[model samples]
Target: MPARLFAVVFGVLLTPSFLLGQVGGDRLIARISRDDANGDGKLTEAEFTGPRRLFETLDGDGDGVLVIEEAAARLAKVRSNVAKAIENRSEEMGNQSQREAIRRRLQETRGGARARVEPDHENIRYGDHERHVFDVYLAETEADEPAPCMIWIHGGGFRRGDKSEGGLFARSFTENGIHYVTLNYRLSQHAIAPACFEDCARALQTIRYNADKWNIDKTRIAIGGGSAGAGLSQWIAFTPDRADPLADDPVLRESTRVSGIILLNAQTSYDYRWIQEHVPGEAWKGDGLQQLFGYDVDRLDEISDAKFELIEECSPLNHLTADDPPMMLFYRRSSDPEIAEKNAMDGIHHPIFGTELKKKADQLGVGCEVFSVENENDMRVYNQRWTMAVDFLKRQFESVQ
Candidate 1:
């Protein structure tokens, strides 16, 4: 199993006390608790699916049984050791240290899988900006036909993320006969709203302009990402084709329209007013909102009309029409309004975002599927969401063919 998967299972099962205090903790605990085969409110070696060594560690007191309380205490000690190691290191650490550590672990665990298919091209410039670069993983298909392509955008609430994050999906798509491209774009901190959107648009156009060189079927391209990246994908998919025939730049003349889009934990609309009305609680107060729109969130009531219009223009929901491509949305959060109301972060990624978008798609006779984790059964199915998304993309490309 991948180390990230191990982290998820162990994080949920062994650190119950730590997780239970956070958002969706109870649901995560309940999901992992299903592994307790003999159901005496504890997990034994036979019941655990993780590494035996890990199981042994969690089984405190040499009891051969692992309960939540004991596991939590053991995990606390493990955290203390990690903290000490960080302190002993000569390098300085800050807020980003934890994120960097997780990223390093992910890269280490995925090293073998990543080595199977290296990028055919890395850091290909799409625009003049330093961040306007993408990596391409060509499909390993035996056939001579150009492969369908999917461009992935990394999610960091429009503030922080890297193209390296695409490593998670690159192998999966390329092995299945789909060309995968992951790109970096300007974050909200670099420039607001349209700058990030424009960077992505330019990246798509650049890909299409060089389609023949990469053996990519430009007509069958799709876009996807998580969170802020998902919103960017939606923005590109729903908007009118951004092809500029009269533009001076040759790349800009290429069409930006895609066959389909896949969104994971997406915020379909970033309009503060729409979010406040549609999603319960303080969903509008999410990070990067003010930076994205270039407006003061606290002074929204006194904002100029032009700023309000900018918000509408930036929101993917406002761009949706009959011409938009089909979309498959997977949200990790529950659809329950009460759950959304309880946490700001939960509200930001709540399933209501997908439901609202689906409603609009249905009215326009467009294909849209929304999936959310509402219970243990839903959690089980959630593990298959990636496969379902790939199937959805395949169908989309087939339809166009």
Candidate 2:
């Protein structure tokens, strides 16, 4: 489990009173209540299948994996489906308030969509069990040269998300001349932090190992993700030095650095200053965060130091040296006015807190661009973000050529 995630879950379980006033508290509680098994009102393996199915759907490549692009594509589909459902349900109910609520839910559902994707399925080993898998959206593009590749990681706070959710974005990337791969990683209560990261790492290794066959530029691979997955993607770029030397598998031994990165509304740090002031409780327990770090707050200092080591090794911001690859970021408007106002009040310009990071990149002479999606509609935001990202990748790919 990741330490940051551990903090989140710890906050959830230990502070029931505090969570009553949380922004999305009721919805989260309902999800947890319905999904938990054993009448324990907590998540168990049995209760986690809903999220896992979603994850499997996102890993469209049938390579027994999930990547960022595929994950985004899958979520986009869910969003689209939810939106369509709401619209239909709204018309049936014929109530302005009810219809508006459903419409808003649908709008939030497809918060990330722009491309189209078709996934292939397969099975992979999970311990002694064989589980389903998925791969990227490839619609038979016959290129003379290997296509530039991207592997997307989905964000659901490492609990509930899928690569296929990146449907629209994945299709857009592939159409723009980049081969996209999406996959599912082990999630909380099913597996923990390193489990998901290891899954993502393995998927990339599989692609690189089979690059010749897949016609991909093994050297030009890029990684991107939204929210929590974005943090994981950043981990891959930041922790290049921690590449295992004695690992038996070639992919495990390989470095995780990519030629570039695309981040959207990522939670960049876990210093606990802001969350402590605002959330100040333990109602977030049994959430995906605890599963990632493998520890609670009591052991956090030791874990924090250890994770800081990992952070130094894995944070892209730390590796913002001249040799680092070009990076692009997108920030969408926060749904909550208070959160949005806090951002403005604090001078925290970008939703992902990339303003300072961009400045650092400029000083280092590394190329970095930042874009903000002004719209609240998921489709429009997805369209704008993908356009900007595709343009950036075109330039990067052309520069290398």
Candidate 3:
């Protein structure tokens, strides 16, 4: 083997515990055992094919021969050392921003796998804006009865996400006899608060308008999203029904009432003052705040009363009431105040948002459940939360029926 190829092969063989896993380790060991030229369970220097330096390293006891058992033990030690080095480096270098970036990349990769289940209807326009289009995945149900629907909106702090992010939830919901719809709305770059909110509202109304054709249960619809999208879902769910029965536009006549809502790492309020008061940090100072509200960030201290009214109006918490749909909120961050106050992103998606919302929901006798991960790195718990969200939505639909 060429020096590079030999290095690659040896690298794979040495790190089998980490790179190839247990099954792969077995196969590699078998391959190495085949090189036992003298029918012994060990390889002498004459039989070893890799560099002398590597053989010496694997020998572990300065022995002239490489015993398979000893080599396996050495590999395990190497794997442990590599893992510790990575863990230490991560602890030293991992900041919220870098972690968030890694999370986005992972989501993007998983989002690609989700994209495999193509939409039944793609780019169906609900309004004049280009971003007003939505993709629908009709339920795979056999019954004639209309199926409950779930609409997902993407989150990027109102600036950077795509409706395709909804692909993550498409299969799970559709497989359970529920219709799934994912949509794109105007971002901060396109327009501010009410525009994105109205765009999503219009999309919901449009879906309701085509209820019969899509075999949708208009009354059993639910809305959900993460971060900015979660905030939008709450805005739609908590607000009074926006149906204009006598409107000339038939779509506008459709009710925007949903039976439930799922919020993932959601921000219940967008008002800077409310955020500061509840979140214990400068969450209001996050990027895109100015663009989101169409106000100058530097002049926030002197913001006019009219602009403050707009802020309050856009906040979902302000609109929540006893009559609003039941809600399920999930947060990846811990509820510890000190941790939440450590960074802008943490403060922005703090579990306290859910706690505060649940308190009010309890006061008003509304159904609200908040789940937070004590260990944010545990993906199993993160994934389980989403499973619980789907179950919660199904239960909500069942209750209403």
Pitting candidate 1 against candidate 3, the one with the higher TM-score is 1
Q: Model 1's lDDT to the true fold? A: 0.76
Candidate 2 regions with alpha-carbon error over 4 angstroms: 1-116, 120-134, 241-248, 253-255, 273-288, 295-316, 334-352, 373-382
Query: Across residues 213-319, which tens digit of lDDT does each residue of candidate 3 receive?
Result: 88999889999998889989999998888999999999999998999998888889998878879897778786656789888767777888988988898899999
lDDT (Cα, 0-100) at 238 in candidate 2: 57
Best by TM-score: 1
Candidate 3, superposed: residue stretches over 4 Å from native: 1-116, 376-379
Backbone clashes counted, model 1: 0
Residue 57 in candidate 2, Cα distance off native in Å: 14
TM-score of 1: 0.73
Model 2 residue 350 CA deviation (Å) reads 6.6
Q: What does candidate 2's lDDT look like per residue over 1-401, in tens digits?
A: 34443333323222233432333434434454555344432232334444453333333322222333334455446535543654465454555565355544443444423324465333322222121243655524675678788777777666666666666467567657788777667776576555666666666766666677668877778888876677677667655534577988665665666778888766454333333333323312323454555656556656666764543443346655767778887765333334433322112213445655677779988787765544446446544767778777777777776
The root-mean-square deviation over C-alpha atoms between each candidate and the true structure, in angstroms, is 12.7, 12.9, 16.8
Each model's lDDT: 0.76, 0.55, 0.75
Indicate whether candidate 1 or candidate 3 has the larger lDDT: 1
Model 3 steric clash pairs: none
In model 2, the Cα lDDT at residue 181 comes to 75
Give the local distance difference test score of model 3.
0.75
